[model samples]
Target: MERILLQLSYNGADFQGFQIQNEGRTVQYELERILKRMHKDFIRIHPSSRTDKGVHALMQYVHFDTTLSLPTNKWQHAFNSALPDDIYINEVTKINADFHSRYDCVGKAYRYKVYKAPHRDVLKRGIETHITETLDTRKMNEAAQYFIGTHDFTSFCSAKTEIENKERTMYKFEVIETDTGYEFFVIGSGFLYNMVRIMVHFLMDVGRGKRQGSEIPAIIAASDRTKAGKTAPAEGLYLEKIYLSPEELTQDIPKGTTITLKPTRRQLTQQS
Candidate 1:
């Protein structure tokens, strides 16, 4: 058996979520279905991260063990042939059996987009959240700085999450103003359930003059979910990228390999 790693992107509007559920459609279900067809047997794929329903992925990674020995380039073509147009397999590589797509990831980056307008952009609906109120980007950026570094994010996670440890390191958090709206880029060692969405909500609150930027520290110290703003919509979230250690990344893919995929037209408009 050989371990294989694949990089892919998917538009999440049509699926329930990344993981397979008993009833609804899912990205994992479609992927595994295609893999079963290729191998003529059951195959399971482990993803780098789990995204909520309507959360898109720009560069998602997955790994699985397979007995088939197809060339790396052909693997992409074969998988793309069966997968839906919204999902595309960009690259594939052979990897060591010990490498894991999730546990081995050292860091990840996520992006949340918000469009400020009196009315929703019909073209970008369901991909970018629309806010009728004007947002102060400067104040949002100031609030975002407080989220950098390590902290117990209990106040910023969903109440439905069962994880006990809420400590995670925030390597970078910045709010960039775009022509149409704002883009929140967050990089972290790890994140709790709905952590990014809650952060975005709080930042938006700060931008709307409903909260003070200086209150972030005290809110985080509360360790209560009620202290944070409401969770943002899942449609605004995107799994921007996943980072692996130099050693782990080099073990499979060659040096200078570019894993970034070109953003689709919808993604481009959202960023704009």
Candidate 2:
């Protein structure tokens, strides 16, 4: 058997989440079902991250072992032919047996889209969060700067989260304004359950003048969940990218494939 990695994207409005559940449809379940039909056996996949319900992904990663030896480029086409419309495989590559999609990831970036128009966009329903109130992106950016460092994120996580260690490093956090709304982007070493949503909620409070930008440090230091703002709805969140070491990702890469490593701040600015 050869280990294979797949890069894919999905719209999560209809699925329960990325993982399999006993009672609901999920991305993993659908992907595995298609694989089983194609390979004529049970096939399991390991995803890089577990996204909550209604959370979308632009560049999710997964790895699985398969006996079939289809050409790498053809693998994406073959998988997309059988997979549901909401989920699409973008690329496939062979990898070393030891390569892992989750553990090997060094960083991840997530984006939260907030629609601040007087009326909601009918086309964006179930995809973007609608807020009727105007949001101050400058204040939100100021508040977000406090999150850019290593700290215990207990206050920003869900109460139901079971992880004992809440410390994680935030490498980048920024709020950018668009014509109709705001975009909150966060890149971190790791994140606790609901951490990004809570952070966004806090930034919203700051933007609405309910909280001060300077108050963020104390709130983070408090480590009390009650001190944090409410969790933002999952529909607005998207897993934008996952970062892996160049060496780990280059193994057995397909010819003609161009991998773009994690972008620097300048690159992001240029793209913006």
Candidate 3:
């Protein structure tokens, strides 16, 4: 009955998305299959967030229950040995029973890379989106600052969202110019469906002079999906990290059996 938290990272080029689906392959489905093969039982891996198709994850958190007495290192070794090269489990730890990878997360960060050059590199085709339009990085960066703070981000979300709450806190949102492209990074306490992508789309539009940068505030005020820009391509987005405050990571003792032969305190500290 012990909970095992897995640090997951994947390319996300070939998979449909993070969740298990009936139509095509997915990260969760593959992980679940490996888990069933290893334990001979269905093990559910609860992901921190559900990324859209073609979206990548540099670091993703997932948790599952395991009854095996094997150590965390053994679990990691077993899982990695079975998983394909494209998908890797960076770390595994025995977390507090009450800790949830998704619900307990305090924030999520994502990065969208746009290649602005005319020539495209074949190597980066799957990782970065190519756009030849000349952009004003300064204006885009200025526009990004408007998104920082708590707001009703209904206008930036996808029309397909079924979630009730569109209110989310944008702690940090910035656009940085790179050697070959521009990177749009956003950190938020929560996000609605395709919120980051839509935000990026607006910024791109602003960079291209299609819309004034100040229109962002009006769009936020409007809270209408049509007021925002288009949703950016999924290939350019990556789930950078998920944060859980130290307080949230701590255990709240409950009426449950504790494992006796768990790793030492020092080893457990390294897990975080």
Q: What does candidate 3 score on TM?
A: 0.89
Ten contiguous residues with the weakest lDDT in model 1 = 263-272
Please give the RMSD of candidate 2 to the true structure: 7.2
lDDT tens digits, residues 111-196, model 2?
Answer: 99998877888999879999999888888998898998788999899989998988887777899999878999988777899999
Cα error of candidate 2 at position 164, Å: 2.3
Give the per-residue lDDT digits (tens) of candidate 3, residues 68-135. Answer: 77788888898899888878999887888777777767668899999987788788877999998778
- In order, the Cα lDDT scores of the candidates are 0.84, 0.84, 0.82
Candidate 3 — which residues are off by over 4 angstroms?
Answer: 246-272
Q: Give one clash count per candidate, in the order shown.
A: 0, 0, 0
TM-score of 2: 0.89
List ranges where model 1 is wrong by over 4 Å.
246-272
Ranking by TM-score: 3, 1, 2
Which clashing pairs does model 3 show? Answer: none
How do the residues 115-161 of candidate 1 rate in per-residue lDDT, one tens digit apiece? 88998889887799999888998999988989877899999999888
Error of 2 at 129 (Å): 0.7
